[model samples]
Target: MPPFDQTRFRLPRGARADAVLAGGVFVVVALGAEGQRLSHGEDSAPSQIASWLLIAAVCGTLLFRRRYPVTAGWFTVLGTGAYYLLSDIDGPLVIVPIVALYALAAQGRMQAAIGMAAAMIIGMAAITLAGSSDVTGTAVFMLTGWLVAVVALGSARHSRLAYAEEEARLRATEERLRIARELHDVIGHNISMINVQAGAALFRLKKDPAQAEEALGAIKASSKETLRELRATLGVLRRVDEQAPTAPAPGLARAAELVASAQLAGLPVRIERTGPERSLSAPVDLAAYRIVQESLTNAAKHSGAGQVTIRLAYGDRELALDIEDDGQGSAARPAGSGGGSGITGMTERARALGGELTAGPRPEGGFAVRARLPYGTTGKPMERSDR
Candidate 1:
């Protein structure tokens, strides 16, 4: 039975819930008024009937409390005053107005709620001073406290709900950005290789059939990898209630594959490692791999480089990456600065892991992307201070 989805049977909210609450308050106030009338035996029948009608009207205002909080708040306050004036019994009818005040404050009407609460407190104090009815000064003081508490609780509820909504929005934005980066890294790199191999195949097809066949094979491999990675990336969005993906995310372990693919795409790549090799956290590893992949893609597509070098320096607390291509000095732009998000995405990834990435043309006649990624840290990355 699907575990009986408790949310499906939870208490109502909004208008329907207000209706329920109004009905419950009406019953309680009505019973209290009737008991007081019986105990006093001084109120006339007409007055008693008028008090019941007033109670009904005041409680009915709660039905629109959520939809029209301010209007209902004022109506309930005034209606309660009328109820007291018409009826000899001081019952629990004030509860309706208190609830209305809460609704007003919860709807972000702090000014109006505070105003109405002050008016009620002052009016009660005036009545106590005038010596009308049996209500005491202490009762008025208690009512002030109740009103203050209700407004405070309502405002707190509003702030909490606002914060939760903002948090949800931020999470959604982060997820979208993550998906976009993944798609670009997975599909963009493979597609660029496919395009280059297709061009090479067409250029050699007439004169060199064997070379063209090799290029076609490279194209086929690139396409197959593209589809596989694309499917895996999209599968994450489709799986909401299913088991998490068992496949490991692409990390530094796959750097050799990237190098091989770039080589097939006619870009020579050499990887130099320094310091002892060590495992890294998943996020840091993924970021490092993606930074390398994006740098290579940019080089293959934009940089007219005959050779590229990727250096990895492992340290006790940080990993440093340096990818430099000996391409045309003026033509080498890190991650194709011509309106693509490649470099931006890579920089965001590094920064999210408490790291820094810098990409620009090197003074020594090439383009370089240098990054310093912390091993594990709780601090956020400082703002991007270097291009």
Candidate 2:
């Protein structure tokens, strides 16, 4: 048989849970009180007259334990002690205190639980050792064991809840960081091109109307691309049931458009491919595209590179991406000092997919970004089927 799926018990939480638990305990104790009444002779009606009422009081107070664990625990424990002092019966009613102790411990009230446990241990010892008492050492041992088990269960429950909450928080943090990187790459690249084109349009507005018109066209194209990419990047935040925007994510297949936009931004970029071009997974393709985009943008903005080159090489076991700029390189903008979110974002993208990216000044000149993404586990990329 298949293992049972335990996720079914991850029930919605609220006060109703407390009511259900308290009601179940109430039924068990009510039955026990009935049995106690039956055991008594006709002459002892006084002791058994209101016993069920007392059990009701104990279980009813426990309903509030989830919201006020410490307070409810004390009320129930004191009620049990009172019952023990007045009643001639034992055993069946002991579950009342055990349940309360478990609640207190599970709620993370260690001090209150410890106090109640000590009180019960002392009370049991006193009552058992008193005149003509027949309770044996094994009974005491069993009671002690039950108390320890109650505390252990509660502590384990508290620890699991805390750990699950922390795990959720960490997942949220990682998701936000990933979104931040996407936003940085999209906005930073497009806005840089837009800014450059706007400047060109302003410079040529009176001197050369044709050049000014062309610059404005580039600005329009870049603006549209920016909005589309922005929507795609932010669409992950939408509800799962909601329909996402139709804009597709940027990938290596559209890399030429990125190079064209860079050229219009006053930096000439040449893109090349080696080995047979094959289809890559969407995530790897997006990462590779963004890496090239950021490198080209950085070259235009900081390095003042007149010419940049992007190379995509497909291997039997891995895909390699190289970006090199022929600008002043480290001389114009020193390595690591050109500091911004660009390189860091690129590095994050690479590492997220178990790849490594290295970027620094070349031995001869210019800066180079080289990334190696292994694909053996995923197998060699298959050739894209043409329409």
Task: Please give the clash total of every predicted structure, in order.
Answer: 0, 0
lDDT of each: 0.86, 0.80
Give the range of the ten consecutive residues with the poorest summed lDDT in model 1: 378-387
Reference-based TM-score, model 1 = 0.91
**Candidate 2 lowest-lDDT run of ten:** 41-50
Give per-residue lDDT, candidate 2, residue 223: 96
Residue 291 alpha-carbon offset, candidate 1, angstroms: 0.5
lDDT of 2 by residue, 1-387 (tens): 988898866764577777777788888887776676667633255656545566778888877877777787888878887777776655276787789898778878889998888888877787788843646667778888889889989989988998999999999999998888888888988998899889889999999999899889999999998998776665557745546666556888788888888877778888878887776787888899899988887887778787898998988877899999877766766545435577888888899888999898888778899998765355454675443
TM-score of each: 0.91, 0.86
Off by over 4 Å in 1: 1-8, 240-248, 330-340, 377-387
- Per-residue C-alpha lDDT of model 1 across residues 103-212, encoded as one tens digit per residue: 77887899989988998898899889999767789989899999999999999999998999999999999999999999888888889888877888898999999988
How much is 369 displaced in model 1, in angstroms?
A: 0.6
**Model 2: residue 364 alpha-carbon error in angstroms:** 2.6
Instruction: Give the lDDT of residue 177 in candidate 1.
Output: 92
Model 2 clash tally, residue pairs? 0
